[model samples]
Target: MQITQKIPPFLERNLGNVLIIAFLAILYIPILLYWYDGWLNKSINIEHEYFSHALIGFPYATYLIFGKNRHQWQKLPNKNHPLGGFLLALGLAFYITGSAELVAISFPIIITGVMLWLKGMPGLRLNGFPLLLILLATPNSIPYLLTPYTLPLQKFIAAMAGFLLQQLRVNSQVDGIYLYVNNIPVEVAPYCAGLKMLFTSLYVSLLLLHWTGKISDRGRVITLLSGALIISTLANIIRNTLLAVFHGNGQHKAFEILHDGWGGDIYSTGMLIVIIGLNWSLDRFEESSMIISDEKDDNFNE
Candidate 1:
């Protein structure tokens, strides 16, 4: 005897939608209960620093995910897997442990489990980068972790600024992280050390690479990210040097303007422009090389 199993037509046809709705519902409760405060705090923290601009990546990621999945949603298979179940349990356990950082970190796992259960591996592949972008919304705290490196960075910036000031015939002396010009002390604060800018630049670089489709190539992606980081650091150093010069020269108004006003905004904007421009140029170069290679192959065949 042979046994046959069948799915009802309605259930089979609407399974994708039903699974998606169920997945969202499953994610909603835990996220709201366990992770909302962390997200709120992240939003609050970005309001007053270089990281403020990185908040844009959240909506951008949402749009990217929606755009990526909009056409494929109906094609997704509705299937449940044992791995998805395990991941879901693990994510919940992390959330229930009441560690805010862990909860924030677990979101992608939870969402991945839902996607895998709903649409299997294909869904996970399609949503991975967008899902990972959620981590960018985690509050920026790398500065605290890199506190050991801050003093050295501050000292370096102060020294460089002092050297530049001396080259310009302005008497300046570097005392640790302080640059004294005409005996006016200019402290190289941690904020001036560019940690915040570095973090923001890295986030923006990743977002750009993902959006531009360059992230598919691991080598190029690493190169682009490294370039972005270097450019950001250099830009910060330049800004800090200029600020030091202004403060050393006893230009209090100029220093304050650059530190906290339109001057600061302009400098940040310029740094971002340079970073984005470099990324665009690198992507174009890659595309051009690919085209040239294809043409060479065609010629060789002919």
Candidate 2:
């Protein structure tokens, strides 16, 4: 038997190609401006912020290059179709106003919007892209919508770290943003909260879902997000401890290294590697279980 895949009626009608070209233009033009500004202002550079910022536009670029999910955009109305472009513009505008961090965070939502648009969910999955993008992006950089949660999460994590330190008998106390350990001051700032890693972890989780195509929609989200949260928390603890130790040594080097983007990059990259490894391992186990189940079913039939 020959297997045939279904194409959207709109695509069959030539509407899909038109929309793709138009959206492709829309996405690229603003992205170009975003880059031009970055170059003129020297925000994200080839040396330091090179891969970090370039990776932000990966989802849309990937979708366009492969055209694997282009048909999904056919389901959206004209106004709703290019949702990612609008958010990208908004995010770019925010960046221009001296909000580079927010801009970086906004990339997640924008990318997510583009992904969902390509996937072509029923109803207004367009709106959902922005929301999901925002959810994933919000924690990574500065929070624009739910700014309150940032502080709460930071404090909660810091407190937990302090408790853990005590359990380990390392003599630690939570003093506002400072973790006092044996009269040594350890600062728990926003950067040290592993926000970048948290955001990166979430991105990796989404990438896993898209790549494996093994897990159900619900399972993909639940498992990926659970792993992300766990890994993010662990990364945060490690980052906090590093800060405490480095600061205690009377060396302000970590901040300089972190601010130069190396420390954060190393930590975020490490977290991503671990998360990907976990996803791959779990997927392999799941596949093996399914194969075993299939064999059992065949044996029973025999």
- Which 10-residue span in candidate 2 carries the lowest summed lDDT? 137-146
Tell me the tens digit of each residue's lDDT in model 2 across 42-66.
4844322233333543543445334
lDDT of 1 by residue, 208-235 (tens): 8877777777987788779878888788
How far off is residue 253 in model 2, in Å? 1.5
What TM-score does candidate 1 get on C-alpha atoms?
Answer: 0.72
Total clashing pairs for each candidate? 0, 1
* Model 2 lDDT at residue 248: 58
Question: What lDDT does model 1 reach?
Answer: 0.72
